[model samples]
Target: MAEIRLENVVKRFGTVTAVDHGTLTIEDQEFVVLVGPSGCGKSTILRLIAGLEEMTEGYIYIGDQIVNYVEPKDRDIAMVFQNYALYPHMNVYMNMAFGLKLRRFSAEEMDRRVHEAAAILGIDELLDRKPRQLSGGQSQRVAMGRAIVRKPKAFLFDEPLSNLDAKLRVSMRGEIRNLHDRLKTTTVYVTHDQVEAMTLADRVVVINQGVIQQVGAPLEVYDHPINTFVAGFIGSPAMNFIDCRVVQDGPNILLDGESFQFPLSATKDGMQIFSHLLGKEVILGLRPEDIEDREFVKDQKEGIIKATVNMVEPMGANVHLRVASGMHHIIACVSPKTRAKAGENIDLVCDLSKVHLFDKETEKVISKSPITG
Candidate 1:
């Protein structure tokens, strides 16, 4: 295993910059995921690290060696592509053993490595099967086996499970995580799926428009996003944002939404944080899960909002509500027992302790509530 480092890495194609001055470090044996939307330069960063794309500027290091000009074969990294780049003509065993064969390993050594990898991936019985005969998940396992046999310093995966069905994708996610845990090889995975990044990564590097947005553990990023982009992108159902003005209602500070208003809970931290923003417009962010049906809440008097339910989706464990309160459209994930129905007025209580405030102009978070276990 090796620690990988990129220092001010920049990659540009003519006038378009794909990666802009990115500097990060992947600790030895750590699983780091590069996550963002499509065309956000995550794959480009992976390619740059794997020596598949030349860096327009800056340097890359594997261990202590600078490898800006190193050939891909000499970089000691194995890459698994989204398409599972397997040989159609060769069976699983041969395909997995081909790299070692080219490296001129002894026949016995190659066989042992291939068998070990096959067993680890639970593909030992499928060794004689060709790529055409294998299912998508099995084919992916073979591709991973190919990478594992090489015993490289690091592994790079570029959306490795994109082609699988949803159920298979979830299954493969657990398999990949288990593989990483057992092997403990330094891994860099790239994907646009937030769920995949959240589940597989020890640290997630969020990118947007060719720039690094935030890097943290999944829960850390989910709970305390630095800005609006990170806040909206990392969570499922996305956080709802409402534009409101900070107003003083006598001695209490409140967020005024024109049609409705709620007093800021009298927490010492809340007072200190919102005192300076009086009379200025700010964006209030609330996660779907943080807004609950008032009937289910223990304290129904605080942070109450009345809205007309626009739509209702009954998920197995929870009901998702799309409601309109004044000019804001909000989504709330309430308990499955919620009596809220479409076209009816409902009362929802916001968990003020979990509120997020962002500067209207900069869209950067000014205050985020502490995360509880």
Candidate 2:
């Protein structure tokens, strides 16, 4: 219902900083997700905006009002916590109505709000059941139902799906997104789960060690990560990082790896960035999905690198291969019928267009694909 903005926000505990000079604006009716590893200050940012934790320095604005010193209740935000926080003694109906009742709404009004919320969440039949009688998914629905009835300025969810089983988590995730679509409520969700962040958010804010790494649409960040940390952390199997020294053979920029030497493509802008770094060390990053079985490769002879498979994990749709090339270990995802067995030398084709280059010292991605221009 309202936009949330944090400008130059700083939250510190003694000598350690949890969030450093953070500035971000969540547009009205937009669903934004704060995603990072644990202890990376994402939850702190949420609490800071929720007025649960006072900012050590800087200002927080809910809508146009500067709420830096406002109380949590006065901020008019609803938070769905990880633990669900449902009172065991109260049935689903009572739990959903508690907030409205406290605000002194009439019985008829409470009935309207509670029933509307329960219908929205598809928990109308479970309204008479206590928390003890419900499943994990049902309990979470009750928690969400409670927040829906309040109709707060914005919704903040802090790993609310952590308690559910994997299958239920997937189902609940869809349910929550659908609910957001219908309500059009401004929502800020925090999660360490990159998959959840990728699937649920309109925009993802990546944080690490009290610093903002990148902020963009999930696929945008995944396709063109700003740094090695963002590149590795955002993907499921994690991007493969190989240490190599940059090589310059006249006009061509080359990467000389452990057992492979390949010329960088010229499809990217600013070749001057790599031209000066020849002979300097850099990290070559490739996603597992980009490496495929050589036999199925389009350009088999062009960018194939040979490595010995160490192990193979047979996932239903694809097989994951752990391969060793000289001293470096890399994982590759290939078809289940790859025919590449453990200890066998296999020709793995690298999709050059999907490869990444990172500065060894700063660890920032040089480009999405090998830069040519």
Candidate 3:
């Protein structure tokens, strides 16, 4: 395993900038995932690191070697593509052994590595099956197995599970994570799926419009996004953003969203960070889970806000309520037992401690709940 580093990397496609000057370090044996929407340069960045596509500027280092001019085959990196890039005519055994054969490995060495990788991937029984006869997931495993036999310094994956069914994607996700834990190989993965990034990464790199937005562990980035784009991008159902006016009544600081207002009872540090904007426009961000059913919350530190239910979507574990509080339309994830009906008004307890404040002008996060939560 080896650490991978990219320094001021830039990749341009003639008139379009595919990847701006982006720098990142992936520690040895760590699994880092690059995630963003399509055309956001995630795949381009991954290809740059793999030397599949040359960077227009900057340098890529694998371990102690600068690989900017290194050929992909000599870069000591193995890549697993979205399409599994397997040999259609070769059986699993031959395909997995092909790389070793090209590199002039002894017959015993090739057989040992092939069987070991197949056993590790639980694909021992399918060694004789041709790629044409394999399922999507099996084909993907064989693709990964091909990389494993090489035992390269690092493994690069480009949305390897995209072609699989949802259930298969989830199952493959665990298998990949488990493989990482066991092999401790340095891995750089690229995907547009936030769920996959959250589940399979040691650190997630959020890239958008060819720029790096934020880098952190899954929950760290989720709980405290650095900007509006990341706030709206990281989570499922997404965080709700309502433009509100800050009104101070006596000792309480309240946000008046033309339709409804929620009290801001921030901790001492939180207050110090946001108290100056008491009378200005600020964007209030609250996760769906942060808005709870009034009946379930015993302690209501935050005042309840009434909203007219616009839609009710029942997900298995929780119910999603789309409600309008005056001109602001937002979603609240509440208990499945919530009896709130469409067109009816209901009170939702906005947990002030869970609130996030962002500057209206800069669009950068101003403050967020303490990490203890």
Candidate 4:
């Protein structure tokens, strides 16, 4: 295991910049995920680290050595691609042992390593099966087993589970996490799926338009996003953004949306925190989970918004409501017992204490209410 570091990394293709001055460190045995939408340069960064792509400007370090000019084979890292990349003619055992064979390992040593890796992955019985005969999940395990037997300094996965079905993806996610726990190998995973990043990463590096947005623990990013982009991109249902102006209602400060108004602060300190934005427009952000159906809310005195339900999706444990409040469309995750239905007016209680305020011009978070739940 080794720590990997990138210093001022920049990758450009002709006139387009793929990665812009990215500097980060992956601690030894830590699992870091590079998560972003397609064409966000996450895979480019991985390839750069693996010595597969030349950095336009920067230095990469594996342990204490600078490897900018190192050949990929000398980088001591194993990469698992989106496609399994298994040898079609070779069975699972040979495919996993091929790397060792090329390295000229003794037959007995290669045999022991291959079988051990297969057993760890629970695929010992599938050793003789060809890639064509294996299911997607099984093929993925073989790919992982191939990487494990090499015991490289770091493992890079480029969306290894994308080919699997949803249920298999979830199951494989657990298996991957378990594999990491047992091996404790340094890992860098690239994926566009936020759920995968949230569940798999020790630290998630969120990227957008080839730029790093925010790097934090999943809950940290979810609870306290650096900006609107990070706030909207990290959540499942996504946060609702409403345009509102800060106004003073006698002694209380309130956010005045065209359709609704909510108190910014009832306490002196809360008022002081938001006093600067007295008459300026700001964006109010509320997560779906933070908005509750009025019928289920115990305290209905604050942050009430009346909306016409446009659609209702009944998830097993919760219901997703798509409602319109004047011009703003909002999604709220309420309890499954909610009586809300399409075409009916419903009241929603937005948890004021969990609200996020962003500067309208910069779209950067100016203030975040303390988390109550």
The candidate, 3 or 4, that scores higher on TM-score is 4
Q: Candidates 1 and 3: which is better by TM-score?
A: 1
Q: For model 1, how does the per-residue alpha-carbon lDDT over 31-120 read when each residue is reduced to its tens digit?
A: 999999999999999999999999999999999999999999999999999998899999999999999999999999999999999999
lDDT of each: 0.92, 0.90, 0.88, 0.93
Candidate 2 deviant stretches above 4 angstroms: 266-273, 371-373
Per-residue lDDT tens digits for candidate 2, residues 37-106, read: 9899999999998998988989999999999878998998999999988999999999999999998989
Model 3 CA RMSD to the hidden true structure, in angstroms: 2.0
Q: Which residue pairs clash within candidate 3?
A: none
* Backbone clashes, each candidate: 0, 3, 0, 0
Count of backbone collisions within predicted model 4: 0
lDDT of 4: 0.93
Instruction: Name the better of 1 and 2 by lDDT.
Output: 1
Against the true structure, what is each candidate's TM-score? 0.97, 0.96, 0.95, 0.97
Where does candidate 1 stray beyond 4 Å? 265-270, 370-373
The whole-model C-alpha lDDT of candidate 1 against the native structure comes to 0.92
Per-residue lDDT, model 1, residue 346, is 94
Off by over 4 Å in 4: 370-373
